[model samples]
Target chain A: MLIELQGIVKDYRLGLEIVHALNGIDIRIDQNEYVAIMGPSGSGKSTLMNLIGCLDTPTEGTYFLNGSNVSHMDDDQLAEIRNREIGFVFQNFNLLPRASALHNVELPLIYNGTPASQRRDLAEEALIKVGLKDRMGHRPNELSGGQRQRVAVARALVNKPSIILADEPTGNLDTRTGDEIMDLFEDLHDGGNTIILVTHEEYIAEHSDRIIRLRDGRVERDESN
Target chain B: MQFRESVFIALDVIRNHKMRSFLTLLGVIIGVMSIIGMQSLIEGFQKNIRHQMEQLGASVFQVQKFPVQFGQQDREKYRNRKDLTWDHARVIEQYCTAVAQVGPEAWQWGIMAKYRDRRTGPANHLAGGVPAFFPNNGYFIEAGRALSDTDIQHNRQVAVIGQDILEKLFPYENPIGEHIIVDGRRYQVIGTLEKSGSAFGESQDNRIVIPLSTFLKFYGQNRSLNITVLAASPELMDTAIEQVIGVLRAVRKVPPGEPNDFEIFSSESLIETFDNMTRAVRIGAIVIVSFALLVAGIGIMNIMLVSIRERKREIGIRMAIGARRRDILFQFLVEAVFLSEIGGILGILAGVGIGQLVALVSPVPASIPVFTIVLGFVFCSLVGLVFGVYPAAKASGLDPIESLRYE
Candidate 1:
């Protein structure tokens, strides 16, 4: 197993009351798996994605990434794990507005202490992989919405992590552009890379080979497509 | 992350927000400007004063009836003291073993010099001194001869003029062997002294020197005399001063256990006095500049906080892209330091320009101290680091999930 979550429970303090965001959840994902986590609003899908991406530690549980228990890790340790093993794709296409697409792709390598000459080559390769070779010099504001999302995808792929965790990657795109991004993801999956996607739309989840549906912080269904 | 990467990012952000960055740097600019500009001026003024004191000759001291006054003093006490005379100079020259030479001098200011048809303005000073005055007062004969012992003993009506008198009275012809009238008295010019520059905006080379015997015959015998004494060598200056003081007290009949009723000063003493007088001004300037830097530092903190608030989502994106907390912190700190360093360089340039400008238009000399430049650079960076901490920490401590979701 590349990732294993055992009895994860997350709670939030909303004003004076405690809300259970994730309640006693357990899941397993192996290497090279294409999985989708689906849920309605306020169903803990985003919370689960945060844990899987190492953006947050589990409030109560054991999270094993490559057989290493990361639930007890501190912030700096989790940041290192995120840098080495997990890549994130946000719904809003979170790219640095002032940086070029190539520079944006280079950011991950920069944090991982890659040499400058090698970092540039890797970022260029990642941009070419995302079919943005001609638009590598464009900034986020100068690119179209689909192209911006492509840049975000390139950034996620630059470090060659164990899994790319994308949250509603097409939430802001039109149907045609959204389908184009999904096709790119299909090509990536065919290339034998692990992918975990979080989405609310049934059509979006249908692209994945396995689906786990969550409701009110609990898994309602788990099935292989 | 590499420091170069943080600096490049900082440059990009500053370029993107040109107006905001300039506004944020204004306080630092002004703070550093005042510090360098004021210090340069003060240093120039001090150098000019020291140069003037040095012109009084090396290892030489003087005795006068009144002390050099700073602010307030008892005027009646100084006025009641006996006037120093040539007799005191004679006694010190005879009794003091460490004294090499004694030159007695008396002067009257605002006297006019007339030659043929040319007349100088009524700002010329007339002085009476023996031949020893030339070496003791740092004056060298540029043309012809200075006053001789025979000229003083025989009371000859001869004068050695300064460069200003030579220029004003004898612009077209030689001043040597020509007679000039001063206060209805005629004296033949025997020589001209070298051009000694002015001090504190007053011309030093605008005077006429005559024999002391002739000066006493014409002016009167009641005027006070200033006695100039040169030590045997530079190393003997302290012993020379002590011997002269003892001889003066004995000649003036100063009682035991009582203070001498005269003042003695030297070039070193004058420099020391100037330092003491300007100490308060230096401290006051530093206090004011420090306050300016304090306020400037506060301004930087406020702006850094605002910048962090505006870029919360950007910080979140960086954090999401695998930036550690320390990486984020270092990035913001570098940006702040870059801003202040730029301000420091600009201020130093402006200060040097101002110093040179003042030197150009006035008599005060200007000099740029390398230490001050380095100090300014270090101080500005320190201010940036101190002020940048809170905002950078706030940025790094932000929750990645919440920051990503920030609207």
Candidate 2:
């Protein structure tokens, strides 16, 4: 198993109330599986994604990535795990505004202590793979929306992470650009990379082999697409 | 994250916000400018004084009726004291065994010198001294013979002119054997003294030296005399001073337990006095500059905090991509240090320029103190570190999840 979540519970304090964002969620994902998590607003899908991404630790239960329990790890250790094991693509394309595409792609490797020489070659290869070789020198603002998303994708893939976790990757894109990103994800899945995507669109979910639906912070349905 | 990366980012940010960075660096610039500029000027002033003292000779001391006064004093106390005369100089020379030589000198300022048609300005200094006075006061004869004892015995109207007088009165001709008129009196020029540069914007080489007897005859017999006493060697200076003081006290009938009516001053004592007087000035300048630096430090902190706030999303993205809290902290710390160091470097340049500018317009020479340059760099770095901590900590301690959500 590549990922295992056992009875994960997450809580939030909204003023005077204790809101249960995640209520006893259990799931298992194997290597190279393309999975989509789907929910409407207030369904705790984002919270669960955050926990899986190691951006937040679970309040209860355990998370095992590659058979190592990571739920109790400290912040820096979790950051290392995020750097080495998972790559994230956000809906809004959270790229550094002032950095060139190549430099943005090299950020993760920089944090991982990669040498400058090798980091550049790897970033360049990743940009080329994402069909943005010509756009490597362009800053985020200089690129089109589609090209920016492609740079973000190149950043996610440059680390050669075990799982690419994308949150609403096409939320800000036009329909045609959105289709292009979904097609790119299909190519990544075909290349034997494990991919986890969170979205509310059913059509986007259809691109994954399996879909897990959440409602009221609980798993409502789980089935192969 | 690598230190180099953080510095590069900082440079990029500063370049993008040129006006803002300059404004932020203003206080540090002013602070360091004042510190370096003031220190250089003060150092130059001290150097000039020390050089003048060296010209006064190392083993020599002076006896005067009045002390060198800085500010206001009770004039009545000095007024009642009897003037030191050539008789006291003779007694010290004869009775003080430790004294090698005693040269009594008196001065009349604003005396004009006329040679043929060429004449010096009325700001000339006319000094009268014995033959020993020339060597004792570091005024070695550059050309011709110094005043001989025969000149003093006969009260001859012969003068040894300084380089300024020579150049002004006899620019193209040799001043030796020439006659010059001073205050309607004609005196033959015997020799010229070597050039001793000016001190404190007043020319040292604008004087005419005549025999003490001749000066007494023309100026007045009642005028006080300043006696310069040189010890046989530097090691005998203290003993020679004591012997001369004893001789003066005995000859002048000063009571044993009362303070001497005259003052004794040496090069070392003058230097010490100059240091003490300027110590307060140095402290005042430092205090004022420190306040400016403090304000500059505060400005850095303020701008850093604002930068953190503005870059919250960037921080979150970095954290999400695997930057540890320490990496974030290091990044911001380096940024702050970079800002201050740039300000420090610019300040040093400006300060040195200001010091040189003053030197160009005046007699004080600009001497760049290497210690102050190093000190400026260290101080600016410290200010950045001290003031940078709070903002950097805040930046590193930011919750990645929350930060990522920040618009």
Candidate 3:
């Protein structure tokens, strides 16, 4: 098992009321497994994704990532975990607008204190893996929706992290570009990379090796595809 | 993140907002400029005073009936005292064991000199002293000899003209052995002095030297005399001064346990007085300039806050990619420091230019040492750091999830 979540719970305060963003939940994901978390709006999927990404600590739960307890880690310790272990791809692409594609891919390596000489080679290889070798010098604004997402994907892979966590990776693209991105993720999964995705589309869930559905801040169903 | 990456990010932001960066840097620029400019002028003034004092001989002191002053009340206080005279100088030289030599000088300012068909205006100084006056006061003969002991003993009407007098009275010919009319009386010019440049815009070589006897005859015996005494060595200066005071008290018949009426001044005292006067002005200038820098620092803080707010989403993205809190802080701090340093460098250049301009047009001398430039840079950068901390901390303390969601 690469990730294990036990009895996770998250709470929020809204003025005079306490809201439960995530109710009790348990999950286990094995190495190289492709999983998609499905939910509608206000179904706690975002909160769960935030927890899995090590971005937020659970109020009452224990999270074991690669056999290390991470739910109680501090901000800097979590940042180190994020740098060395997790790669995130956002729905909006989250590419630095002014940076060239190559520089964007090199961001994760820079944060990890990689030497400048080696960072170039690793970033270039990641770009080439995502079919962005020729367009590495272009800025995000100059690239199309799919190309920008590919650049973001390359940035995520440059660190060779344990798992790739992409939140609504195809939310901003048309159907054609969306299918292309899903095909790219399929290719990455076939290459033996662990991938966890969050989405609301049933068709997207069908492509994953396993599916977990959330409703009212609790898991409604979990099944292998 | 690495320091180099932080610098690169800072440079990128500055390049993106050219006008904003310039506006933020203006205060630092003006503050540093004034500091360097004022320092240069003050240094120049002190140097000029030190040079004049050096010319007057480092180990010498002056004794007169009254202190150097301009107030009417001071003049009235010294009016009843007996004038310092050549006889008093003689008494000190004879009795003071620590004294090396004593030279008595009597001065008449604004005297005119005429040679042949040419004449100078009433801007000349007519001084009467013995042979030791030339060497003791750092004046050297450029042409002929100086006043001799025989000239003073016999009261000869011979003079050694300064370079200004020589140039004005005998521009095309040698002044030695010529007869010059000074204040309607003819005196034989025995020599011409080498040129000694001006200080504080006052020409040093605009005078003629004549014998004490001849000066007494021409300018009257009622004039007070100032005695210049050189010590045997610098270490014996205090002893020499005390011995001269003792001899003067006995010769003038002053009663025991009474205060001496004469005032003795040395180059050290004069320099101390100059420093005291300039110190107050220096403090005032620094206080005023610091307020300007304060305003500049505030301006930098304001802009940095705006920059942080504007780039909230960017900060979130960086944090999501593994940028720690200190990394964010370091990046913003570097940006602010870079802005201030740029302003400081420009200020140094402008300050040196302004200092040189003032020197050219006025009496103040200007010198820009390397220390002032370094000080300007260091001070402004400190200002940047101090003011930058608050904004950088604010940026670094933001919640990563919130910042990423900022519109």
Candidate 4:
């Protein structure tokens, strides 16, 4: 298993009340897995996604990434892990609006301390992988919505991390563009990448190899397609 | 990589919001300008004063009975030393080899002179000195002739009138051949001096110069001898001074290694003393310039923090993409340093210009200290780097997710 979370629990303190955001979540994901975590609004799905991506630490239990106990990591270690092992894709197509597509893809290598020559080369390669070779110089504002998401995907894939964690990656895209983004995810899964996505749409989850549905701070179903 | 990217990023950020960036750096500009401009003006005054003092005479030194400057006790203790007499000056002339000339002069206070019942009632000044007085003090005789050594030996009652006296006392007559009543004695006017306008504020052309012997009978051996010595050249100054000191020490018989009992004042020494005394003012100026720099640093920090707040989401996106905390920090810091350096450069130019203006309008000459300008640049750059650190660190420390979600 590339990712394993056992008995994970998370709680938030809302002033005087302790609100349980995630409870007894147990899951395993292997390399080449295409998984979507789906739930209605207010379910613990986004909270679980946050934990899986190392954006937050679990309140209880252990999360092992490639056999490393991620739950034990400190803030700096978590950030390091996020940079080296986990790639994140966000709903708003969170590409830096001012940066060129190629430059946007070069960000991970920048944090990775890659020298300039290699950064340019690898960022270009990543842009090519996302079929944005001709749009490398165009900024996000100059690109189409689908082209912007492609740049975001290029950014996620540039570091060659062990897992890609995306939350609502197509929430702002049209059906045609959404299908194209799903196809890219499918392509990345076939290329032996561990892909975890969070969404609320049944059709989006149906395209995944596995779907984990959450309801009211609890995992309601864990099914493999 | 960090440096290059940060520079490019900073430049982009600054360019993207030109107005905001200039406004943010305005405090730094004003602060730097004040320090540079005012310092230049002060430096100009000091320079002009130094030059004016230097021109008094290269080799000349002044001698007075009570030291021109001395401790209260020293003045009192030496107060009774028999006034320097003509014989002592003659002894110095016979002994010191390095001295080129020693002209002793005397001052007559509050006296009245009369010319043919048109009472020129005491001129305010009637000075008595030997002929060597002209060259020793860089003065030249403009009329008939200066008082000769023979005139002093015979005590002949002849006088050299300054131009102002010529205008006032002998406007209707040829003053050189005329006789004037000076201190209850009739004296022939031997010469008239050229108008020597005072380089400083006082008038130089108003005095009457007569021979020491002529002055002695009327004023006599009661007064101290005031002498000026001329050295052959600037190189011979120290040798001449040492020779004079040795002659004085032998005459006074000052004990072997004991400090000289008599005082000597040279133009160089005077210049040195004046410069040394202004040390406190220089220190105060430095402290003030540093304080302005500090305030400028604080201003950079404040403005940078505001910029970070305004760009929180942008920072978060950069971080998420792979920007290390330090990368973000460096980017902001580079921007700050750039802003301040621009201001510092402008300030230095303004400062030099201000100094020039002061020199042009005031009596003082503008002297720009090269060291101060160089130091100002280094200090300004350092201030930018230091003050930008905290804000840069704060930006670097932001959590990516939280920053991204910030509205």
TM-scores for chain A over all candidates:
0.98, 0.99, 0.99, 0.97
Alpha-carbon RMSD of each model: 2.0, 1.9, 3.0, 6.9
Candidates in descending DockQ order:
2, 1, 3, 4
**Best candidate, lDDT:** 2
Per-prediction DockQ scores? 0.76, 0.81, 0.68, 0.30
The order by descending TM-score is 2, 1, 3, 4
Q: Which CAPRI level is candidate 2?
A: high
Please write out the lDDT profile of model 2 over residues B128-182, one tens digit for every residue: 9998888788888999989989999999999999998998999899889999999
* Candidate 2 C-alpha error for residue B57, in Å: 3.1
Judging by DockQ, tell me the better candidate of 1 and 3: 1
Off by over 4 Å in 1: B46-56, B74-77, B213-223
Between prediction 1 and prediction 4, the one with superior TM-score is 1
* Model 4 misplaced stretches (Cα beyond 4 Å): B38-59, B64-98, B103-227, B231-264, B324-327, B356-368
For candidate 3, report its TM-score.
0.91
lDDT of 2 by residue, A5-105 (tens): 99999999899999999999999999999999999999999999999999999999999998889999999999999999889999999999999999999
Best of the two (1, 4) by DockQ: 1
Please write out the lDDT profile of model 3 over residues B103-187, one tens digit for every residue: 9999999999998889888888999999878866778999889999999999999999888888788878877888999888889
The residue-level lDDT of candidate 3 at A20 comes to 98
